[model samples]
Target: MSRPQGVGDGGQGHKAKHTVLALAVAALNFGIAQGFFAPLENHPSLLQARLGLEAAQAQLRATQSPVSLQAQGGVSFFEVTPPPGPPTCPNPLNPQCITLPSDGRQITLGLTFTPFPFGDVSDAVNQAAIGVEQAALGLRQARTQLEAQAVEAFLRVRLAERGLEVARLGVRLAQASLEAAKLRESRGAASPSEVRQAEASLRQAALQQADAERNLTLAKQGLADLVGPSSDPPPRLIVPSEGTPPQVRQAELQLANAQVAYDRAVRGVLPVVQGSYTRNTSDNDSLTLSLNSRTLQPSLSYTNQSQGRSAPQDRIVGTLQIGLSANIAFGVLDALEAAQKQVEAARQAVEAARRSSKQQEDLLRSALQTAEQGLANAQQARSDAERSLAEARERERLGLASPLATLQAELALAQAQLNLEQAELGRTQRILDLYRFYALPLSEVNR
Candidate 1:
């Protein structure tokens, strides 16, 4: 009785599964385009560099307005004090000058100077930092999701590959049984019905074999698509060397790191408030030189002009002045509020993402548990089949079993062996799953 080879060194299966899983993991890693790639791991401050650079350059390029001395052309006005003119004196020609009393007895002219306020270069820096952080955060979220997908794919390939070996063995054993029946029938010992039964069995085995083959083929194709450079499927069951889960802790670790990175990036979304105050003063040379607090008793201005065509007694006078000024604009508060709202929204998104990830972690843990149980059950079934085949062989040797009985025993044995193979396959698959759950690639686990 030729029984299919059921046991393996668990080496080849491990290697194959690990390789495929690794390829899948890498594919996901690259696809994310965010997580590992998006965050400025080495330089969180790099985001602020642009603002810093521009500010430095602007500062260097900044030109200060010279205290310009030029021919002033704008309307200039000022108050002057004249000598106490007799308010009650009604001199015929002086009536218009100072008929009634006035606070200031004279008039004077002065020029006002103002400077335009400019925007800070630092704001541009902050904006760029904000954008970089947002982009980095988005990419990170996508990357983490991809990592999970990769792990799942890797585990799937390993799972399918485990079932392939036994299924093929079943086909080989059935063929052997069918050949034996044909030989016995040709010698007129086996019944036609028996031969036909064997043939049918063989056909069923073949179908199952074909199915396994298809699954493996499809799995290979999937792996190839994920990894740019790949290898053809290796022959035989590939098993991990140590039979241990590889990189099983990586998943949680990666998620943790991602959380921290996202947190830092989020800070950029906060509203930045900026303000400054300045005091300045400038005036015409005459106004500056003549302005004084000295109280003119007469509260008036008088100018005596004895030059050019003016008569020697001709006089013109002006008064002194003092004052305060101010200006204000609205709407800065509204802009600040909008910026704060945007920050709040970004923070909320981060929280939502974290909660979702936690749930995914829980689901993965459940999948791992199921896979472990499946592997154990398959192993137990294989052991039972082996014992049944041994008993059948012994019964046949004693002539207590008919050819049909022996055939049944043989069939049982093949099925048992197939089950064993499946078990071994299942075991390896479970390990792969564990690796994936941890967010580690098959290569690390298999190795």
Candidate 2:
């Protein structure tokens, strides 16, 4: 009562494995373009960086403008009466009752400008410009980080999809094997224990299929969270040739800002020159110029009556004023020394960052090489498994192999194919890591 040696699925399961393999190979030939990452531009961190850049730009604009203008207007009501109860008019019937207007309106316009800024004002501008640069770099760094995340998510989805298909194929092969084992048991040539073993294998395959499905679902959800609800994953890895790592660029900018601070501390002790213009409705129109230093301030001003308001010639005058002031602090020298130290520290940080980046690049290159080797080995194993399965089928046809032997061969082939797919996915991941480390663009579709 022996079951036939060649008993399962005719070659359907084998063909399905081949189909998955072909799909995986096609994926390897297709490279994901940068357009795929465009959807991630709206990621929260990226949006934050963009906002920071805009703020920095506004600050820079404010710093570049040294002049300010202001306008103020108001209405006032007042009454005036002669002191002591006295009638100024001589006529008894018409006493000289002097009365003043009860209400008046006035407007004032003022303008102030720094003709030449000193004592850290110019330094303020330079610092603001540096801040703008830093913000721009930060935005670029955020984009690169988003690209890295997108690539990782993409890899997970691709691997999970392949795993789910492979698991399904495994289930099918297991079911076929179990059916052959049952036939043998019904023929009284196989024990109940053997049938139970086949059942156990089927259950294991089902469990694996369920796990694969869960993983794929989770991978898809994570990807959607990153890019959007609709994500079209790229077929394969995209690696750019070269780029400066964003961290190193950011550190260099920091060093520049530090250097600027040091320069400001050394050169910010010069005198300042300022000018102002003021217009008033009731009093005078004035133009003033001044020079100020830490120890002294000298100013010259000219005032004249308004065109529509009459005034004595004496009201128009020129005035010169000189004021002396001093402020001595214990930490002035210490502050300069501290700024110098910061510059040196920032320079050192830049060097350290460069060294660390280079080390990371070397490590990634080594890892990529290892991944390539692993992929080659997996492909070789799959080839061997295919040969073994073919041999097993030929033996069964010649009546030289048992049903159990053929089933094992088929299982080996399925596992080898799965391993090959996984290896391919791993190699793509290594390439992505290398590209991401360099802050290189992953896609050139739009470039």
TM-score of each: 0.40, 0.72
User: Candidate 1, 210: how far from true, in Å?
Assistant: 3.9
Candidate 1's displacement at residue 64, Å, is 26
Please provide the root mean square deviation of candidate 2 (C-alpha atoms, Å).
Answer: 12.9
Candidate 1 lDDT at 308 equals 20
Collision count for each candidate, in order: 35, 2
Error of 1 at 378 (Å): 2.1
lDDT of 2 by residue, 1-447 (tens): 664688679566887899999887655434334346767777889899999999999998886666766566677777766634464655444434534456666555555455554445566777888889888877766776777677678778877887887788778778887998899899998999999998999999999999999999999898888877655565355544556776788788889889888886665443343333332323446556555553123333444433334345435454455554443467778888999999999999999999998898888878888989999999999999999999999999899997667777877887787788788777877887776676554553122
lDDT of each: 0.47, 0.72
TM-score of 1: 0.40
Query: Cα miss at 229, model 2 (Å)?
Result: 6.0
Query: 289-357 in candidate 1: lDDT tens per residue?
Result: 222111111111212211122233223222234443322236544545555565565566556655665
* Best candidate (score: TM-score): 2
Off by over 4 Å in 1: 1-169, 172-198, 221-334, 393-447
